[model samples]
Target: MPRDTPPAERGQRLAVYSHSDKRVVLHVRTNAITHLPPAASKDFLLLCPHQGVGEDDPAGSCPRGNTCQYVHADLRGAHRTTPHTKRGAVAGFYQTHLPGSRWLVHLPVDGECPPKLAILPSRCVLVTRATPADAQGSLPTACPHFTLRHRCDRGVRCRYVHAVASPPESGIQPGRCLTGGWQNDPYRAVPVLQSPEFDLTEHLPFA
Candidate 1:
């Protein structure tokens, strides 16, 4: 896993990936991610929905609308997708309102990939922000991108999960096919991160 903020520094650009005609950056109103640990290892991709995103250029105009270029995939049970074959595969990502918070994940051994992120279920952990939850029901309307402590089965603390790009409502969306597969794919056998910076996480879904 990447160090929380260093993940940002690893990024050489500000945009994670541009979908549709319009490009999507960190949104304060429409979209957001949250609840990152001080470790800063969990990387998250800020992806826009399957809408026409504007692709406006920097200090100028975009020839095409900022929309995503990746193909619409029908997520199945335990099925995973990747941006390698897609045009808008996110090569990097940026952290909002934080210094040295722009980092680009290394491309998958196969094609390209955004940085890896480890965010909890629905809780958003902020630097100085905290929101309260309700009783006997769903979480707050304003969902935090990431939470640290996610409770689960067998007296086990499943708190160290990463925030993947797949949709949350669906399962297997959290796991991605990256680096390499167990065959001709070169990255299959290798771990995503080469350095020792990321050792706290659990078995990779890809692994």
Candidate 2:
């Protein structure tokens, strides 16, 4: 049924952020998040800092311009000038960059869903495993079969280690993995078989 749904329709659903009562509701299928009700005294909505800074102005313009990633007041047609007070500016900056801020959350564009949010194949393990150490005097090289084919016919009975070495971090932030599903099942003791086509690190958010 998910595959049958039109991409445009899915995207439209993801863009809808509704709030009821005080708790937030997360639409896993659409990646839409309903935020908690804002406090009466504080408005959480943040305006973009580069709203009116002209390209040629010495103050410097919004680097992204029309394509700026932030929520700009001018782009939203609010027509409000940037705050001059230090307190107002600081509050706005924190609200805009807060880890859990709603403004930072965005719907996937052009059907390019985050890998962790996307429905990955249930037959694979999403977590990368650390490689096993070599025996006392044995060579540190990995098993040829496991390195070349990701698996060996001998299974646990193999003389050499069959684990895949975790790759070095690329310093790129990975997609967030929501709890639940077979890929995240805690009761399952055995790790799923790794597939050469899918790199485990690429799918894990904390990897």
Instruction: List clash counts for every candidate, in order.
Output: 46, 0
Question: Which regions in candidate 2 have their CA more than 4 angstroms from the true location?
Answer: 1-136, 166-207
Q: For candidate 1, give the lDDT of residue 163.
A: 26
Q: Candidate 2, which ten residues in sequence have the lowest lDDT sum?
A: 101-110
Model 1, range 70-140, lDDT digits (tens) per residue?
22211111111221111121232211123332222221211232223232222112111212232642222
Among these predicted structures, which one has the highest lDDT?
2
| Model 2 lDDT tens row, 27-125 | 122122112123322223322344332111311354664454332222211111211121222222211111221111111111112221111221211
lDDT of candidate 1?
0.23
Model 1 residue-pair collision total? 46
